[model samples]
Each structure stands twice: as structure tokens, then as C-alpha cells.
Target: MGERYEYVPHRLLRRRVRDIASGVEGELMAVISENVSGVGAEHWVELAYVRGPSGREFTTSVGNIESAPGGEAG
Candidate 1:
């Protein structure tokens, strides 16, 4: 069997993120890094580090990320 990959939406990457502590919204600069794994049958988790325009970074985890429409997984 071959390893399966997931696709992240480019739009989502560009969306602004709000800081929970101060309620400030910052622009998402880039997806700095990502880690993905299958936890069980039909279940997966992805952890991604996103950089802000101000050079701040934050970690976010998402589950069951699907491939983008008309796009290939990476």
C-alpha cells in the first residue's frame, strides 16, 4: 500500500487568525510546517504551524482534512 496524503486549502492558509488572549486578528503569512498521521480507520489528525504577517507563529491542529477541489494531495 502507498501512503496517503491530505491537501490544505490555500485560502484557509491566507485567512487571518484571531488571538485568543488579546482578541487581535493577524494575517496569516504562510504555513510554515505540518505534520499528519492516521490515528485509526478513517480517522486522521494534522498539526500545522502558521506564520503571521508580524512574524508570530501559532500551532493549529485539524482532523480529517480533505483534498482540495481539483487539486492533488501533498
Candidate 2:
């Protein structure tokens, strides 16, 4: 038997996610929200999705919808 500590893949991809929702609650700041209750006349949403291109396409949440104070969302 042998132990494996090394591994190789064809490609490597990494992402980082951060939520500043609580910090900008009702403050005209950018938010990542998703309607978990479904789309309707009375629907609520939660802060989900990351910041980047093709939003909500990755494991991240809250992006491209708004800017970070003095910066723009990329």
C-alpha cells in the first residue's frame, strides 16, 4: 500500500467570496440577492451570488449588481 500526497489536474481554478450585505443593509449599497421564495407579487430574497463576470455562475455571490463604495463591480 502507498499513500498519495501529490495530485495533478489539467487545469486549476480558484475563487474567493465575501458578503458585505450586513454592512450595507438598506444603505444604497450593492447586494447579492436571490428570490428563494419564488417570483411573484409577494416574494422575498436572500443575499446570494458572488462578484465577477457571468454572476451567479460560480460558487460566489453578490457581484456586478453594484459598486463597492468608490469602486465599480467587475
Indicate which candidate wins on TM-score.
Answer: 1
Top lDDT prediction, candidate number: 1
TM-score for each predicted model, relative to the true structure: 0.35, 0.19
Clashes of each: 0, 6
Task: Give the 10-residue window scoring lowest on summed lDDT in candidate 2.
Answer: 4-13
Which stretches of model 2 miss by more than 4 angstroms?
1-30, 34-41, 51-74
**What's the TM for model 2?**
0.19
The superposed Cα distance between candidate 2 and the true structure at residue 31, in angstroms, equals 2.1
Per-residue lDDT of candidate 1, residues 1-74 (tens digit)? 23454455544455555434444444443443233335645534454444545677665543212223332321
Provide the lowest-lDDT 10-residue window in model 1.
64-73
